[model samples]
Target: LPLKPTPPPFRNHGNFVVSVAELNRWLGERAEEAGAYVLSETVGAKLLVDDDYEQSGERSAGGEASGRDRNAPGRGRSTVIGVRTGDKGRDKDGGRKSNFEPGSDVVARATVLAEGCWGHLTGAALKGLGLAAKDPQVWALGVKEVWEVEQPLDRVIHTLGWPLRPQARFKEFGGSWIYPMNRPGETPRVSIGFVVGLDYADARLSVHDVLQEFKLHPLVRKILTGGKRVAWGAKAIPEGGYWAMPRLHAPGMVICGDGGGMVNVPKLKGIHYAIRSGMLAAETLYSSLKAGSTDFSSYERAVHQSEIGKDLYESRNMKQPFGRGLIVGGAITNAMVVTKGRLPGGHWPTHRDSDQPLLLTDRDKRYPKPDGKYTFDKLSSVFTTGNATRDDAPSHIRIQQRVPRELAEAWKWMCPAAVYEVPEDAPQGSEHVDLIVNPSNCVQCGAITAKGGRLTPPEGGDGPVYQVT
Candidate 1:
């Protein structure tokens, strides 16, 4: 990342590369040392908002309903008082688990959402607060693996272009990354991954297939020639920059990190910003809550005045033009890249990624199936994650009753978990494609939910359990 686009001395070389497990473990240790009463394996069941408008007999300064309108949570600037924790051992199949108990509320002065991308309660909270993203948020699905290689490389690498069809048109903005991992005294290894924009227009674009094809490229195959694969997983990323950010302060809550779309698209970084934002929130809370003040706007203003917002504002226009085409997007991106973001001053309005057309009219697409040794299929890859979702849990995903066949087919390809599929027994050439949902296969990446499916939070501890370094 360069600092020229930014006005002053905020240029950062790059972040130290480390495993997510290791990073989280370190943070957890530090947090405990600082006197935080940390809770594990608990999900925020629901945000608690106040309901005391009648006593005040008032509204917002402009005659809008004051923060306690029970009718519409998304309006009236509701303050989030706290969150209700999901019940332990809770399952939709009533009385199925022996130790079942209903959820309980935990009231607090403030709440912070760093729930990663497409979190279940994020949209609900934003709507409840009556705020919306200026431009729709767009996203991409990243599939990755850790490998112990036969031959070791000592450097980091990034590559774009090729192995992708023109319909997706993500060449200029997103691609593959291969970063070497260093261990105290072990065989040399690397973490490899491919990020394919989820906004792809084809119903045939499978994220696993995209990563598998990326491995076959001449440049990549040489490095992984005889490497042994060790692990696999997938996630979604927010790409829309500054303009896509919604109002940050809720009545009693604030959001940080990727869940708030604070990632810098050009640099493919957000960790530092997340840490900074969290610190800023802490300082504000220390002063405000300690003084018994109800204001939360200070946190938002600090963010806008800090390096995070300036950097985001400077390159605000980078990602959206690609919605038109790579060529058009490329010319604009190239000029900015070459000039350090001085070429653009405004952002374009792009529809939400899901709102884009679901299918390409001229369908002529084929993906090379996995060959086991070097690359494998989705189900097998997910097995490597060791995700053990309950076999008897009820379907937490809800799909509209009469979705068109084309849209249904689109969902089948869009989800990397294989949670969605069409019936194999359908007649040879019939347009009747019945959507089958395998809730057990869901890793809860939230991709299916982003693409028109409604995702209600499942029982606490029902999703994949990733390691904390």
Candidate 2:
């Protein structure tokens, strides 16, 4: 039987909240107890590869190897800078300038890169080794805002919602959280955000825009009706599952947290994976060092045996159609919901068995668009006939009349066709103008004159009534 859920003793107390300082203190105590040296505020520079360490030798492969040759120039020392005082000890600064060192001062026999989303240093090192390449397909943008609410601070509840109407499946892999840990009478704080997929290379869709749209939703707006935005920012969340992961271990180096793209999108969790990876990496390093071995293959093996790896592999398989089919299907389902006033099967759409291809060509019966025109019920397609046809005109023209008077007038005078030929020294003065917007360079206006349309000024109000050609 499944385990029973239990209610918390405190009502409206808010979700779990912990401080970084407390966490670091606990880690220091635990690590020190285990005979491990813990250093804070240290950044990992790069991997130390021993090309001379032969892999074929029986003892060198897994067993004890030679110790640090003190006589060697850069042996037996890992540098660390003192934060309070700018001084470095003998074992710390390894004959490098504070400004010259590429990364932070903290150095060790084995370093684990646990930097969250901002893992530029780790990415650089991986790219240098030819172990990984950047791909937008595996990345996602996360936008969040912290709001101060006027509602009663004692009974604040956290609410998580599915994505808005047409894009339910594209529901970003995140949550909405409200914490009531503010001072006695202070306004409550609520954090809301979404993780958007970065499949499209176009820059048209902004994460901030999506987040603003989310705040405008009826359900979300209800909670934040009287609240004011306190702070907001966007961060990248690594969404690549097993297939997108790079090498976990190399000589003297390892990666953890978002740096390794270890987020579990379905579960909306990553902190646990980050902590476990760090602990495992440290354990692997400790054992290797104690055994007097330089090889770090065991670190790789440990991660593979861990639950994080298993979950990632499973999720990768489970979320196969996430990019295309899931988004499109959600859109179609949303349309049905709006029309029928009920969700399909009276149930929330969960993950589907999506092993099939996401796209449909002429061969697929569901979407057999044999003709050149792309047909869909969502929007109607227009056709063109004459030399100056309405269908061939741009979308800006069709919407111009519906736009506000000021904007419509602006568009009318700054007709893209006319703007394309305005002189460099025309009325608007052109020092900072783009070369592409120089209207005097246009030759197509001659044809408009032949069609009895004045390209320039006319006797009527602001030139002839321009027809959207």
Candidate 3:
């Protein structure tokens, strides 16, 4: 047998890590090169829908779609035909500014949604089209930073159980990652980050602060001894595994990537799945368009029978056990791994992140203050993300101005971008607080959406301008 020659730049052969923002930019460039128009700063605000399924009574009296009609309804069987872009240049009160521009409609035969975790429009499409999964989607907040380090770490590292409480009652489940990002002729770099499940019961737990504490550990400190942080970012991750995945296709549209809950929680990997799902979606769309039909029922079948479905099904019960705490969850996870997910055998129900009740307690974990070097405050971290959000832009976050002290505390601490604040002037001894929202500080991480607030799209390109790798 003849052996195949390995490609040049062999180091890029195996599992590698790259800045997600950088990868996205390169992909966008590649897409543009392929004759696809890549719109920057534009946001898909509303789905242009057709009420054919509803008007035609495609659904039975029980709301189940009739044979071959897969549309389910959060409200009614509204078919997503395309998207409406969000209006720009709106004032804080939503008044048109001098430079105001009305949003435009972009019609298409098919629309593929690849919005990242907990996307606003994704929520709308999921409900409007009745594509929700059996189990509720869960989320975790990830705060990451890239640092220029003196000591170049060659291998990737993952750690668990220090900053987070391990007790089942705490409901804490997460870990941290450290990966080398060394580049030729450039200063040695490494990416360090931490993820915390949003289901934690602690009202004052801060993921950003936890990452700061993670860097202080002697083992982590050694690797980052002379490092200076160059970038910062935060995001929400959908960790609902297979059971939480919604229907992938609806009339005139298909959901792909994280928006479809394609992440494999066990491997902490979703990029490959996202890419693969996108490719499948492209194929499905192409075929549908070629056949002169908007019926994308085939897309759903294609995904379920594809590698994406197979991989997800294998680890279907992976993330649910974590809600019972790391100990029980880890034991079940180990059994599932050993038995190839056959041991669990059935669907383990999950809850939405916001459904977890946060308690106000004197036993809250206290985090160390940022040292301005290894550790950092939320606002300073936002600065590193190159956030250019206008101070006067309309608030895209939707939450009550006044909320219970416990909920207020949760939002204040949960936000890594410091968008929520319990004002200093809040009543001294009240059980409620006036929640002040600083939308300008938001990095559009979508974490708030997981824990009791809604995040809408800002003006096109109004959020953080992530740096290229």
Candidate 4:
């Protein structure tokens, strides 16, 4: 988390790391000083449209689910009036209780969305409202694990190559990271993980299972040999750069951070960009509200002219060529690097990760089994997360009621959480196996979305508990 960690040509340029705990504490002190009332356990289920509030009818909680979707672009003259937080007492399926009262609405002139990659409400608000930019958003799976070790590490480390098999065409698209954490008197801790692009073709390739293989390599295995894994977590990241950023503003709302695709992927950082964006959102909202207007183009103009825009524009085409696999991509990458990222990438069209074809195997090929210490299976990794899902929870993933056998098999291999499965009793190579959902085992890594099982938000406050990841 140092300003820069030897990434080629990478410089902090003032960007730095702050632990989430420190950031939260700082925000709390600031909020308390400013007399801001923070709601911790509430879920903002829907954004209310100013016009629809007066038009009167039973509208669904999310913009798209409701017949009247104000999130859709150019659909109507509806300003975002407020957001409706869900009632805490409602069941998993959202059934109201005997003493049910519709959740209260927080009416604000401006709402800023900082939701990270593929966030439920953010996705709905963008797609339903037709706000997506030229390129579709792409994602990569990043799994992190923390280990408590006896020796202190002198520096941070990052490495590329290995673990990814030959079947995976895009060898350069993923890599490993090892960041050391030192405490004053305690044992040194190392955070290790792998990031694999989701556009990979093989259905059997599991990011969760493969990370164990990454550990078995002598390089990573050495640091982790005597170390005890203390934590585990996973999240999808936005790989699309400026081309994928949605239009930043609408009537009464503006988006910032990951919700607006502010990540500078080539630099491998976004938090600092997010912090800057949040400040811009505040300024844009303040100006609009003071003028008693609903327009938010000021925010868009500011973002396009800010450092965030400059950074994204220069490196916009860097990742797109990698989709063609390592060799061809390597040639293009080197050219761009020499050209300083102004290679006119507009000619190379890019597509969503889901649009990539998946390579299917007949279900008998096997991967090396985990050896417990250097290697691990999926279930045990989920156990270390500490925020494991309840076994009885309702399924939160949305898929076809009766999925085709091929697609079902694909989903089983696609998810790193082991959230989908085929019955043991089903015949091997059979085309009739029912794909079952194990909602409780889910860590919500968002891999299933690439398999066409677009994930929906679980009941509020029901996801991962990050310890040191």
Per-residue CA lDDT of model 3 for 225-270, tens digit only, reads: 8878988889888888787888888778888899998887777778
Give me the overall lDDT of model 2: 0.41
In candidate 2, what are the lDDT values of residues 97-198, reduced to their tens digit? Answer: 433322333435665667565343444434443334232214455544455676634443333233322243333333343443355666766656655444
lDDT of 4 by residue, 370-443 (tens): 77666677778777766545444456677663565666666787677777887788777676667777777788
Q: Over 4 Å off in model 3, which ranges? A: 1-13, 51-77, 362-365
Ranking by TM-score: 3, 1, 4, 2
- Which number leads on lDDT? 3
User: Which of the numbered candidates is closest to the native, going by highest TM-score?
Assistant: 3
Instruction: Give one digit per residue, the lDDT tens place, for model 1 in 1-469.
Output: 2223542212233546687866877899999999998877677767777874211211221121113322232455557788787766645564547777778878888888787777555666655565557566677777888888877777667655445654334322356778877676887778888776667777666776777877887878898888888877788877777877766677678888877778887776788888898999888888888888756778888988998898887767777766656667757876776666778755566456666576544332456667778978888877777777777766667676345677777777767788877777756566556777888787777776556665656777777655521
Error of 2 at 337 (Å): 22
TM-score: the better of candidates 1 and 3? 3
* C-alpha TM-scores of all predictions: 0.88, 0.50, 0.91, 0.87
Q: At residue 282, what lDDT does model 2 achieve?
A: 78
- Stretches off by above 4 angstroms in model 1 are 1-14, 52-77, 92-96, 167-173, 360-365, 428-432
Segments in model 4 whose C-alpha atoms lie over 4 Å from true places:
1-29, 52-75, 90-102, 166-172, 361-368, 388-392
Estimate candidate 1's alpha-carbon lDDT, on a 0 to 1 scale.
0.69
In model 1, the Cα lDDT at residue 227 comes to 85
